[model samples]
Target: MLKFLPGILLLQVITVVLVLIAPTELSGWGWLRLVIPVGIVGVLTAAWFSSMAAHHNKDEISRLQECHAKEREALRVNAERAKHRVIKQAHQETIQEVRRTSTQANIKVGMAFAGAAGIGGLLLLTQFITLGLLMLTTAGGALGGYVLRIRQEKAKMELLPKTKTKPRLINASPTTK
Candidate 1:
């Protein structure tokens, strides 16, 4: 009430004092004198509060939009990090597969070499050199297969992107013997 008292007093002062000072043709219109100003003040106050509510609502909407944008940015960052982790894990698995393939190719190469030596020696002792060519051909085929497998593993390794290894933080205890 105190906050509005000045405005109310000003309205009343205008209605009574302004008409009395001018003594206009409408001054004798007794009730119209007070009613007109009261109605005008009421309309002006209503428009003021309506515009104020609109401004407040606009500010609130902008604040909410900012909050939502921040949340979306956070989600995007987390999703990007998750994708990086998945790619790293895939690379690790690919490296492991390449290692396993290399090991298998080496074993195959050794077996082919050993088989060739054994068959060649056996055929030499029996004096069947012409027929021994078939055994040599078989060993050659195994060696070719080994070479192909090794090449495949090398190609896979080259296809992978290079990643730096981060130093791991190991859990160490001083009491350990």
Candidate 2:
């Protein structure tokens, strides 16, 4: 069936040329003029379908495969970036949380130190030097706690992986962090 294309095309081309070379007027074979074109079209249609039956594929399979591959690649890249966005957003939130915690810790340390200074003053008023020194040591401990919290936050930041800058276009590759 597939071997009939060249023969069918040649026959069609010859018929068309013969018709072209003939007279323009169709007074003699009026019905034949219409039937000839219609018959040729039917024959070509039958030949194309029969060829497909023998060959298993008549359409452009390679072109369709290329289209599907491109679609798959785009979808794959989009899925990766979607996952990256979630992780990147979480990392930024964690950094912001660390900064907030550090600020609060420092504020609390300042208030605690102020209270300790008041206690020291009261002790001094009563002439209790040893107890006043104890209050000062307690204040030092509060400062130490503040320093530890900040240091811990810094360590946490260090442990976290940084996110890289994303490209403006989907086709562009991501830049390193």
lDDT of 2: 0.76
Q: In model 1, what is the error at residue 64, expressed in angstroms?
A: 1.4
- Number of clashing residue pairs in every model? 0, 0
* Candidate 2 residue-wise lDDT at 62: 66
The residue pairs in collision within model 2 are none
lDDT (Cα) of model 1: 0.73
* Model 1 steric clash pairs: none
Cα deviation in Å at residue 97, candidate 2? 1.9
The whole-model lDDT of each prediction reads 0.73, 0.76
* Candidate 1 lDDT over residue span 89-110, tens digit each: 9978997997798788688779
- Model 2 TM-score, all chains together: 0.56
List where candidate 1 sits over 4 angstroms from the true fold: 1-30, 128-161, 164-177
Q: Residues 39-112, candidate 2, lDDT per residue (tens digit)?
A: 77768767776776656553567668889989987887788788778878897899799779868877887887
